[model samples]
Target: MKAKKIERKVSIALLFSITLLCCGGGQSLLAQANPAVFQIFEKYSKQKKVTLLEVSEELMAEYRIKQFKSIIFEDGTLALPEIRRCIEQDKQDAKKLKEATADGLVVSGYYRLKTVDPAMNRYLIFKVGKKNKVTLLYIEGRLTPEELVELLK
Candidate 1:
C-alpha cells in the first residue's frame, strides 16, 4: 500500500514536470508527439497490478534526459488494445526506428517523433514480454537515437 502511494506521487511529479516543460509558450512540446500514450500512464498508474516509475532528472542528467517515464502492467489484457491504438496513431508520423509484429499485431516497437527542438529527441518504446506482460516507456531528452539505443544496451 505504501509503495502504491509512492508510485502515485512519482506519477504526479512527472505530470507536473511535463506540464511545466511541455506547456510553456502556449503550446505543448508533447503535442507534436502522441499525447494519448501519456494518458495511458496517467490512467493506469494507480490501478491494481500496475507499476509506474519516473526517473529523476538528476539521475537522468548523466544521460541528458529531461524526462523518463515507464509503466508495466502485470496483465495487459485490458490496456494492450488501447496502447496498440496509440502506437498506431503515433506511427503515422513518427520515424520507425525498430518494430516487430507477431500474429499480425505489433508486439514490440521503437519510434522517434518529429519535434520542433532539433537537439531534443523524443522516443516511445513498447514491448510485450512473456505471459501478456506489457511495458511502455516514454523518453524525452537531448540524446540522439544512437545514444539512446546505446544507453538501453
Candidate 2:
C-alpha cells in the first residue's frame, strides 16, 4: 500500500509539471513568434489610447507615413463601425499573405494596400482578439510587401 501511494503521488506531480510546461511554453513561443509586433506595442506603451489617428503626421510626426493609417480600439475591442468598414475595405483591396488563429485571437497577414498609389504601397497588419481587442499596424516606405509579409509571419 505504501508503494502504491508513492507511485500515485509521483504520477500526480508529473501531471502537474507537464500541465504547467505546456501552458507556459505556449505563451513564450507565441510571444517569440513575432517579436516585431511586441516591439511595436512596447514602443507605444506610453499612449493612454493609441488610435490610428494618434500616429498620424498631424499628431506624432516621427511615426508618420503619408500613405498609411491605422485604427485601434482604446479598449482593445474592434466593434466600431468605422473600424469594421476599414477592415472590410482592406479585405477587399489588399492581398492576404498569411494568417494564424489561436484561441479567440487572430493575427492576419501583411497586406499591400492596393487602393493606394503604387509608389506609396503601404503594408497593414491586424490583430483581432476577444472582448473587442484590436490592434492595427500600418507601415510605409521602402519595405517590400514580401518583407512585410515575412515580418508578420
Candidate 3:
C-alpha cells in the first residue's frame, strides 16, 4: 500500500511539472484532450522537473509504454500484459507515435536551459506523430532531457 502511494505521488508530480511548462501557452486544449495522460501521471508518481539527458524516437515508444504501465498499476485491476494488449489494439495510435518520432523527435533530444547564475541545462524531447508538436510552448532557455520528456507524460 505504501509503495502504491509513493508511485501515485510521483505520477502526480510529473504531471504537475508538465502542466506548468506545457499548458501555459495560449490555451493549449491539447492537455485537456490528453487527460488520460495527466490522470495516469497524477495517479502514479510525484511531479518532478528532472534535467533532460537525451531522447530518441525509440525512447518515445518506450515512454508511452511506461506511462501506460504506471496507469495500469494504479488501477489495481489491469496488469502490464493487459495494458500491452490495449496498446497493441490501438493500431492507429501506435502508428501515430511512430510517425511522430520519425519527423519531429530530436535524436539526442532538445536542450532546455534552466536555472540562473551558472544555468543548468535540461534536455526537452518530443515525438513527432505525422506532425510537429515539440514546441508546445515557449520553453525557457534550452530544453533539457526532462523538458523534452514533458510531452510524454
Candidate 4:
C-alpha cells in the first residue's frame, strides 16, 4: 500500500509539471507572435515617442506595419481641432472604435498618397475624457485599412 501511494504521488507531480510547462510555453508563443504590439505598449508605458520608421523591420513585419509613429499625451490634454484635423486628412472615413460623448473618442482610419507604390497610411487617435490625455499612432503599411483596424483593436 505504501509503494502504491508513492507511485500515485509521483504520477500526480509529473502531470502537474507537464501542465505548467505547456501553459507557460503557450503564453510565450502568444507574446512572441505579437512582439511589435508588445513593444509599442512598452514604449507607451514609458511615455516615449516612438517613430514607426525607427522600429525594427522584423517587429514591424510581424504586425504588417511598415512604418509607425506614436505620440503620447504629456500635458494630459489635446485640442479638439487637432483631433478633427486627424480625422479630416485625406477625407477618409474614420471608424469609431469607441463612442464619443462628453468624455472622448477613439477613432482610426487610413489613406493612401498618390505615389507609384501607393502605400496606405493608417492612423489611430485616442483621447480620454476632459483630461486631455491622448495617443496618436500613424502606421504606413501594406495591410488594408480594415485589417489595420482589426490589428489595432
Candidate 5:
C-alpha cells in the first residue's frame, strides 16, 4: 500500500467523505441544492407521500421510512418506468427545472405545481394544454396533495 501525500494541507468544508465512502457519491450536488426533498434513501428503502396519507403495501411490510420520493409521472400516475423517465429527463438545467420540480408528476389535461413564492404571496404552477407547447401558470394555490388524487379522477 502507498501512503497518499499532499503538497499542502487544504481545507475541506461540508465534505462528507466518510458517508460517501460508505453510501457513495455524485448525489450531494442535488442535496445541497435541494434540501427540503433531496434526502437520499438506502437500498430497498420504503417511501411515503406526505399528501397521499397512505403507506405503500410493500413499504408497510418493512415498517420503515427511508428517504425516497415515490415515482410520479404525467397524469399523476405512479409508475416506476415513468418515474425513471422523469428522473432521467430532469437532469436538465437544475435552476430552470427548480421553478417547481423538473422531476414533478405531470397530470394530463391539467397543470404542474412549481415553486411557491409566499413572500410576494405568489406561487407558480403550470399545466401543459392539449395544444402544442401550450401551458397554464398558476400563481395561487388550487391543488393540494389530497386534490392530486381527485384531479386524476
Candidate 6:
C-alpha cells in the first residue's frame, strides 16, 4: 500500500510539472529563440534617423501574425556592421528560406528559426537598401512558410 501511495504522488507531481511547462514555459522558449537582432532595436530605436515599429499580437491578428517588430536605420553606417554580425550568428542555427547578395555581401535574407512549439512559427527578415539604409523584421505566427511569403508580397 505504501508503494502504491508513493507511485501516485510521483505521478501527480509529474503531471503538475508538465502542466506548468505547457502553460508557462512557451514564452521563455520564444524569448530564448529570438535572435541577437533585439539588441539592435534596443540600441538604436531611440537614436536619431531610426524608425521602430512594434505591433502587439492582438493588433496583428487580422494579418495572422502573432507578433510583429521592425526597426529601420536610415543611415546604417554604424549599425549595419553590427546587424550583419547578428544576422550571421542567427543564421547558424536557422533555415535560410531566401537570400540575396550584392558584391558578395548578404544584402537581404529570410530565415525560419527552430522553435519548440510546432503551432508557432518564427521568422527573421532583413534588407539593405539605397544609401546603406537597413531594415530588420521579426515575425511570429501560425502561418506556413508559403503563406508568409505571400503575405510579404
TM-score of each candidate? 0.78, 0.43, 0.20, 0.42, 0.18, 0.80
Model 4 stretches astray by more than 4 angstroms? 1-56, 78-121
For candidate 4, write residues 1-153 as lDDT tens digits: 999999999999999999888777665443223212234434444544322234544688877776665555554343444554544542344444444545254333233332224454444444443345455555556777677658858
Identify the leading candidate in terms of TM-score: 6
C-alpha-based local distance difference test score of model 2: 0.55
**lDDT of each prediction vs. the true structure?**
0.88, 0.55, 0.32, 0.50, 0.30, 0.88
Off by more than 4 A, model 3: 1-27, 30-32, 46-153
Candidate 6, pairs of clashing residues: none
- Measured with C-alpha atoms, the lDDT of residue 80 in candidate 3 is 26
Give the clashing residue pairs of candidate 2, or none: 76-132, 76-133, 76-134, 77-132, 77-133, 78-132
Candidate 4 positional error at 70, Å: 0.8
Q: What is the lDDT of candidate 5?
A: 0.30
Please provide, for model 5 over 1-153, each residue's C-alpha lDDT reduced to its tens digit, 9 standing for 90 to 100: 123233222223224555565445534333323321122112112434312122333553332222223222133223333333433343332223233333464422222223333221111223332322222222223334344435335
Candidate 1 on 35-87: residue-level lDDT in tens?
Answer: 45888998999999999989967889999898899999999978999999988
How would you order the candidates by TM-score, starting with the best?
6, 1, 2, 4, 3, 5
Runs off by more than 4 Å, candidate 2: 1-74, 78-82, 100-109, 115-119, 129-132, 149-153
Q: On TM-score, who's better, 1 or 3?
A: 1
Name the lDDT of candidate 6: 0.88
The per-residue C-alpha lDDT of model 4 at residue 49 equals: 31
Tens digits of lDDT, candidate 6, 70-129 = 999898878888999999998998899999998888999999987777777889999999
lDDT of candidate 2 over 12-64, digit per residue (tens): 99999998887787654442233223344444445556654434445433433
